[model samples]
Every structure is written in C-alpha cells, then in structure tokens.
Target: MTDVPAPPTPVTALLRAPRHRVSPRARLMWQVAALVEGAVAIGVLLLVDLAVDQVDLPWWGVVAAVAAVLAWVAVVPQWRYAVHRWEVTETAVHTQSGWWAQEQRIAPLSRIQTVDRAEGAVARVFGLATVTVTTASAAGALEIDGLDRARAQDLVAELTLKADAVEGDAT
Candidate 1:
C-alpha cells in the first residue's frame, strides 16, 4: 500500500509581506528637539512674567512654541512611518514612502551594481544607518536611509548574492 503525503504547512500572515521598519530614534531626535524648544519657551514665559509684573506678551511666546511643537508632534508619525518601510521580495527591493502623497520605488536584483551603508550623528544615537544601492541605469542613485545597521548589512549581503546569481544565469 502507498503512504499518503503530508499536507503543506500554511505560511504565516506576518511573513507574507516581510517589511523592515526604521528605528524609532530615527525621527525621535527631531521630536525631542521640538519638546526642548517648548520647554525653553516655558522658561522664557516665566522670566518675562517676573520682569514686567504684568500678564502681557509672555503668553504669545508660549503659545507660539506650543503651536510649533504641536505641529511637529502631529506630523512626525507619518514621516517616521514612511521612512521605516523597506522590503525585498524574490524579484525586487521595494521602498514605499511619502507624507502628503505616497511613493513606491522598485529595484530589480539584476540592475543593482553595488550596495553601501552610511551613518550620521542622529543615526548613530538611534543605532540606525543607511543603505545605498547603485545601478547602471543612472536614475540618480536610489538611497534607503535610516535603517538599523545590522539589518541593512544583511539586506545588502542577500541582494548581492541574488545579483550574482542573476548575472551568472544571464551568461
């Protein structure tokens, strides 16, 4: 008698669309700066309040700082979200982003010539980095920045391997 074959395991919904998000600290520094500015503004109000012995004009500085801080707070989440999403599929690496409008960019493995990484002051603080992929097509060099460093390196290595495989297949 022939034995029955085992059923295939189902893929996890989470892994179906694998995506890497940017480090929270990638945009936290700017938000923190906004908060500090707001605090300084409060201090300025207190000083002005003591100097004039009148409740006038000091409120305006506080109001302006609060408004600015509020605006930054409101806007940061979307920017951070946009910056975070980076994904690679079997065929291409996809970058989806934008705030007011959405943008999607795709880079095929065969076209990629080099993959590099970068780090800056804020990025270092967040332990975040950048990955730049170069292509022969010359579309002004697409760059994916503000990623966690180890993740970026792993992506680079995988893409490099895929590129080599594709090149070998072509020849």
Candidate 2:
C-alpha cells in the first residue's frame, strides 16, 4: 500500500502591504533598461541564426522571438512598477517586489545584519539605486529596487543607525 501525501499547512499572513511606492521615475528607468536588454537578446539570436549553417531558422521563429521581446519590453516594467513598493518603520523594513512572481518581505530592525545600496550602469544613468537589507533570516535578504539615488543613500544611513540601536541580533 502507498503512503498518503501529507496535508499542506495553512499559514497566516502577518504583514500588510507596504505604504510607499518607488520613485515615479523608476518606470522610465525600467523601460529603458528593458529595451536595451531586448535589443541585445534579439541581436544575439540573429547572430546565432546566421552563424549556424546546419539549421535554417524559419522566418516565423525570428518573428516570434522579436514579438516576445517587444511584449516583455512593453509589459514587465509597467507590471513591476505597479507591484514594487517599500517602507521602513521604527520596527521593520517592509518591501514588495517583482512582476510575474512577487514577494512581500518584512525584516525586523533587530535582525538586520547589514544595509547596502547598489547602482548599475543603467540605474546610475537614470539616477536610481537599489537598497538591500540583510537580515538574519532563513528567507534571505530583502531588496527594494529602483529607488531615487539620494533616497537610497538616506535609507541606507537610516537603517544602519536604527539597526545598530537594536539590542541583540537574533542571528
């Protein structure tokens, strides 16, 4: 006789959605970046199709790839802009991020191990940065991307000070 599968455990949702949306300029930043990425992807595909003599890549296949790129460039950034948000309270840092697969995270100040900011070439050009909050949790670090550059700097400094004030790091 086969063993029966265990029932899935029900989990309570503890955190509410964060209060603040990212900078409005974030949408333009995301759109530009996506366009560059899509162009590179299509260029690479064309190169591969040209280089491979054994395979005659059909016209429909090329058309489909370009269509997919255009759709992603048009859609994903707007979706992500709508979904992404972040806030920091005295107790915790809350964030919601991603487009297709979203994540909502809350990291307690006491559990915070580090706070850092990052800016890619594209992001820097757009005057945007990402803030990462490292916490002593199994779920991993929480990141809030596409924040205003100065705002990100302020967040990093504020989190560092607040996290330092908390007693024991629950690590």
Candidate 3:
C-alpha cells in the first residue's frame, strides 16, 4: 500500500497564494544595476579587444563577448523582476526568485536564528532595502531583496519577534 500525504489546509493555501510581489521600483533598480554592470563588462571587453587587435587576433572573439554580455544584461533583470516574490506568514518566510532556474525557499519561524535589514547605496537612492533571515539549515541565510525601506524594516522586526517566540534548535 502506498501512503499519501495529507492535503493542504486553509492556512497553507493562503500562504501559497501568488498575491505578494516585490516593490515595483525594484524592476527599475535591477535594470539600472544591470546596465551599469553591462557597461563595465563592455568596457573590459573593449580593452581586451584593443589588446587582441595589437596581436592581430580574431575580432569576432571580442564581438561575441560583448554580445553575450549585452544579452545577459538585457534579459536577466526583467526575468528576475517578473519572478521575484516573497511572503511572511505566521509559520514561515517564503521566497521565490531567480531567472532561468527558479528557486523557492521556506524558512520556518522555529528555525530562524536572526533577522537583519540592509540597504546599499543604490537601494537607498530608491528607498529600498533587503531583509536577510538566518536559519539553522545548512543552506545558510535567505535574502528577500527589493522591498520598500519601511516594509523591509517591518518585516525584520516581525520576523525577529516571531523567531523569539518560537522554541527550536536554532543553530
């Protein structure tokens, strides 16, 4: 006889709902960062091309490198922005992110060791912040980025409180 797991409850259903999304400005920030990175990559490739030219190497190599970088810069940010999402429920913190390979993570409150909030210079300019949740799992910390500054702070505070309330082996 095969064993079947029990069906999801109302709470789980609510938690699984695709209702939560990152701040809209996150897309802009991600795109802008991508552009900056792309620019740097292009600059380096151009320098490499210059050196290669001096050696009479194939110009196609440099063109290919720049094309690859441009494609990555153009596609990845939009894909990530469309997919990234996070939700904090009473039981756990759920996050979904990534571009080509999607990833979903759930960190239960009981296993949470700490909650932290951070803001980079670019994020500050956009009034954005990232919340990092440390857990006992071997996977290390989970970061929920691109949240509005105030929302990130609230999430950090709430997660801290929840983690405090739970009793577990929070290694």
Candidate 4:
C-alpha cells in the first residue's frame, strides 16, 4: 500500500507558537507617559469640579476620582508592557499590543511597501524607537514600538531586504 503524506498545518497554528517580548524599559517609558496623562486628566477633572461650584460634589466622588486616576497611572503601564509583543519571521512580522482590548497583526514580507523608523522626544530621551511597517492593507501600517534605537534600525534594514527579495504581491 502507498503511504499518504500528513496534512499541512495551517499558517495560523505555526504563527501561534510563541512571541518575543519588548524591553523592560518599555514599561518604564509607558509609566512615565501614563503619569503625565493622568496628571492632565486629574487637572481637567478638578477644573470641572471648580467650575460647577453650585453643586457640591460628595467627598467620595472626589476620592474615587483621585483613586481611579492614581490606579490607572500605577497599573496600566505594567499591564501594557506585559501584553505587548513582537516577532519577525521569515514570512511575516507579527505584533500584539493592547491592555483592555488586545490586537494581533501579521504583515507578510511580500506585502511590505515601506519600513520606517521614528523617534519622539520622549523616546529619544529613553533611546527607544518605533518601527512602522506599511503594507497594502486598508488598516494602515503596523507599528512595533519600544525597540532600542539600533535594533529598530536593524529591523528596518532587514524588513527592507526581505520585502525586496519577495517577488509577488502579499495580498
């Protein structure tokens, strides 16, 4: 009797094996950013409270508001750091990010139109960079943030080379 070959596994299964995590510095950066945002939010809330002096807010209302802001500033950055991950394979660039709502995206090398590296003022201070991969999809580009500056540059070069090597449309 002739032997039959095993069925090929789906690409999704292969892609799900594991993911690489971002640097610990990412958490620090996020915490700093979150603190800044929390401060702004608290300022706005306080201003609103002052403007509506006709109606006095309960003591618990003010306490809860402050507590919520503090909790967000203290917790969200760490949660985000734990969830954000990225991996570059021969076939695709996979990225997963989010805290409350998770998102995973895969961009095939063949679909890559451009690989860009960007640095914001805060990121520059931390020596971090974000790598953006533009593809043909309508959802826009995929971003891999919190990479070291050198690592981001290397990724850009590597993606560029891989995209160039692939000959067909990745759609």
Q: Who wins the TM-score comparison?
A: 2
Identify the candidate with maximal lDDT. 2
Clashing pairs in 2: none
Kindly list the per-residue Cα lDDT of model 3 for residues 6-97, writing each as its tens digit: 88777656545334788888888887788788778777767776777575436786678678877777788788888888988888888888
> What's model 2's TM-score?
0.88
TM-score of 1: 0.62
The C-alpha TM-scores of every prediction are 0.62, 0.88, 0.81, 0.86
Per-candidate Cα lDDT values, in order, are: 0.69, 0.89, 0.83, 0.85
**On a 0 to 1 TM-score scale, where does candidate 4 land against the true structure?**
0.86
Task: Point out the worst 10-residue segment of candidate 2 by lDDT.
Answer: 8-17
Q: Give the local distance difference test score of model 3.
A: 0.83
Error of 4 at 26 (Å): 0.7
Q: Could you give me the TM-score of model 3 versus the true structure? A: 0.81
lDDT of 4 at 129: 92
- For 1-171, candidate 2 gives per-residue lDDT tens digits of 999997765554456779999988888888888888888988888888899988688999989988998888788889999999999998989899989899988888999998999999989988999998988898999999999999999999999999999898558
lDDT of 2: 0.89
CA error at residue 31 for candidate 2, angstroms: 1.8
Per-residue accuracy of model 1 over 1-171 as CA lDDT, tens digit each: 999997776654323322766666656755665566667877787777778866676567767867876887668654756554778778777775555575556777777778888886666777777888777654545566667788878878988888877753321
How many residue pairs clash in all the candidates, one count each?
1, 0, 0, 0
Candidate 4 wrong stretches, greater than 4 Å: 1-12, 169-171
| Global CA lDDT computed for model 1 | 0.69
Worst 10 residues of 4 by lDDT: 11-20
